[model samples]
Target chain A: MLDLFIDLSLFTMLVATGFAIVKMRRLFGVTMMTGVFSLLSAMLLVTLDAVDVAFTEAAVGAGISTVLMLSTLTLTSRIEKSPVHTPWIPLLVVAVTGAVIIYGTLDMPNFGDANAPAQVGVAAQYMERGPEDMDLPNTVTYILASYRGYDTMGETSVVFTAGVGVLMLISGLRRRRRRKPSRDEGEVS
Target chain B: MPEIEYILGHLNYWLFTVLMMTGLYIVVAKGNLIKKIVGLNLFQSAVFMFYISLGKITGGTAPIFPLDMRIDPATVYTNPLPHVLILTGIVVGIATTSLGLALIVRIREEYNTIEEDEILGIEKELVAQENRTLGDAMGGRA
Candidate 1:
């Protein structure tokens, strides 16, 4: 079955990511693997009838996020050596959260059930009435730019703020470093 | 064909979720900034896949209404809305990437390294020295 292949490929990708995360000594490998993981997820979104989400994810998550992180890495070290200690606290927290999520999903609807409340209720209305609400043909656009316009606008602003903050922080550090090298070198104290 | 339709309809989602979670977990667990961003990309792509798959309609033509045809409820229409949204997102994504990369370059020039732990250590030392200087200015030596 096509599903079997998809499942197998996804599983393989996950295993590879796990191995890379464990075995790779360089931070660069981790960054690349993260991108690969995002791309695979986008492919899956296409399968789930969530094309709009997949597009955003591929573009923003895999593309933009990787670049930003890589830039930050340029200012730091590229590899993390085990310091003879494992972080058991974080591991325990993650395990608990994962268990809770899996347990919660056990009672959830089967995939793509047309009669599910989510499918039959506001979602269907959003799909059906979307054309009427916005002059645009894309229902997702209507939902993002009109129905949920405020959220998108807020997200845009948040991104703008983040860009500004990172610039300012780095600029300040550069100034300090410049002063340190020149003033200390000249003082001869 | 029947089997194909069934597989296409359901199994793809499992693939998408697994990859998505893997990326998310890495992003959250990894301390390296670049690796975290990579994980972020993976997470976002999973969401994109969800949008694309919804547009598929069995035996349906493109959503474009032929100029000759009037309103007909019987016409099977492929979903086009998600595609349009995705186009816009792709453009935004590119902008975000360039901005992030630019920031990374700046970060490199500033800190002289890209490792999170080392950067934090340096930052902490700087802060500690600054505090010491401030205390000395007030005649309170720690």
Candidate 2:
């Protein structure tokens, strides 16, 4: 019952924060709300027993991303210009997509069902043998660093590529300027 | 009683749906490019929530083992796979955000404006100029 209460309240705050983000016109306010939203979701993840994800969300979403966004804001305008186009079409599109997703969820397994397909597959095997095989206190760390190391490597490369791309895009090397001999000589002419 | 149970059991999914839709709305409706990127981040995080929720067991503790390395057969542990995957996802999300912000910086430099509509308008004017020059050469107005 307490879990449910925590879940619902956190979700309420999340939705409220989302609505606030959508309504705000000031880019700074929206950026701050985005950080708040990430932090709230981090709390929700903790309730769902995903401490690793919660940690990452708090670090990356609320910490680093917020700083990056604020710096981006410095390069751009602070307040969003009033939109000339009506938002009806986008609303319709989002509503239809949301309805489809909700309908799809009808056939999904009940939350926390032990017999759910997701809980029974490879996850079960991992739960059964991961600790014994790896002898690690944190199964998440073992799996991330040992069992699924290849995928993590790929993810690292992707991050590196993204960083290199950002550097190339924003800050290419400055070209050396050529100067006339007279200017270099400082009034010798 | 069954209906009430169903609703309670599936409440998490419903919340995920609402968040996903809200993020989608922001991405599609917002004109500011930065706002759109923020919305994309939100949408991706909602997906992370869905995956994490699916991994939760009713009575499970976290997936961490005890410090002494003793294994307890009766103690349930939530799935750690999703958490691992989401760590990679979180890193990727930050990478994408930084890359996108870099692109926005370039766009601002080129166009002197970050608003999507104004950028499109400027491009349209450039296209019209090209068409007029080509049309004169072809002995017809564009």
True contacts kept of 2: 0.84
Tens-digit lDDT track of model 2 for A49-107: 89988998999999999999998999778888888889999999999999999999998
The candidate maximizing lDDT is 2
lDDT of 2: 0.89
DockQ comparisons of all candidates to the true complex: 0.23, 0.81
Model 2: CA > 4 A from native: A173-189, B138-142
Residue A56, candidate 1: how far off, in angstroms? 2.8
Instruction: State the weakest 10-residue window (summed lDDT) of model 1 chain A.
Output: A110-119
